[model samples]
Target: MNIEFTLNGSVQKVTITSVERALDVLARQCGIKSLSGTCFEGQCGNCLVLFDGKPVYSCLMPAFMLRDHRIETTEYFTKTREYSLLYSELTKEGRSLCSSCHSGIMLMGMVLVRSAPTPTRDEIFRTLSNVHCDSISPDDFADAVLKTIQHLTTARKIP
Candidate 1:
């Protein structure tokens, strides 16, 4: 079947089989390079993408589900101010994530901070818990997310 969707601000049409997943279609058919995964089970968030501005595990999403939807890969997101802000806060904590997890974490952070500029620590942790990674301590990750939220709050208050 042929499906059309907006990918990284461009409309694209790709053919997909019933068994094909969005992760594969994005990379193989649509030439999206920012998504990759070790697990196709969605346990690892390495295949994360923004589906209509929300982070989703592409590995588990059927290709047909992407029809008429908007998809944003990490590469596209890297150009956004939200990505820069999240990346800066994460780096300020002095820990570096693997490339895959870094993308997932940053995307998740953007969603969290945008949806709730003043999220509680527990809420932040809960949102971040979706990405399975061991590079940073949970408490440390929470701290970084909190800092990102704080930064956004401060910026919004200015002017």
Candidate 2:
């Protein structure tokens, strides 16, 4: 099957097997290494990607099903102002520890923050439940989300 789609704003067309996983197609075929495949099954959210502006586990999606869809990965998120702010905050105070799980956690946080700029603590926890960041604790994750929300709110305010 031949699939054509926009990857991080770049047009890409590739021939792949209909059953090929989206994660494999992106990483192996397109050189998109950021979409890590920690678990081939959907249990792990490591292969998360934005499909048509919504977060989806690429490992669970078939390549042929994305024939005309738009996919955005961590690379694209890093370029955006919102994500950059969160990234900076996460890095400050030695809080932004990078590991195999950082990409997926950050990606999921971006999606959650974009969808709910003022999410409650529970909402934040729920959003991050699927992630497995060894360097960060639950409290730390909640704090990050709260900080991101506060930062966004403050940025939107006119002094």
Which candidate number has the best lDDT? 1
Q: Tens digits of per-residue lDDT for model 2 on 28-135?
A: 999987778887777667888889987788998988877888998888878777787777766778776666778878887787778754777787777777666777
RMSD of each: 1.9, 1.9
lDDT assessment of candidate 1: 0.81
Alpha-carbon shift of residue 91 in model 2 (angstroms):
3.1
Candidate with top TM-score is 1
The per-residue C-alpha lDDT of model 1 at residue 129 equals 81
Determine which window of 10 residues in candidate 1 has minimal summed lDDT.
Answer: 110-119
| Runs of candidate 1 exceeding 4 Å displacement | none
TM-scores for candidates 1 onward, in order: 0.88, 0.87
- Cα lDDT of all candidates, in order? 0.81, 0.80
lDDT of 1 by residue, 98-146 (tens): 7768777877777776774477878878778878988876787777777
Model 2 TM? 0.87
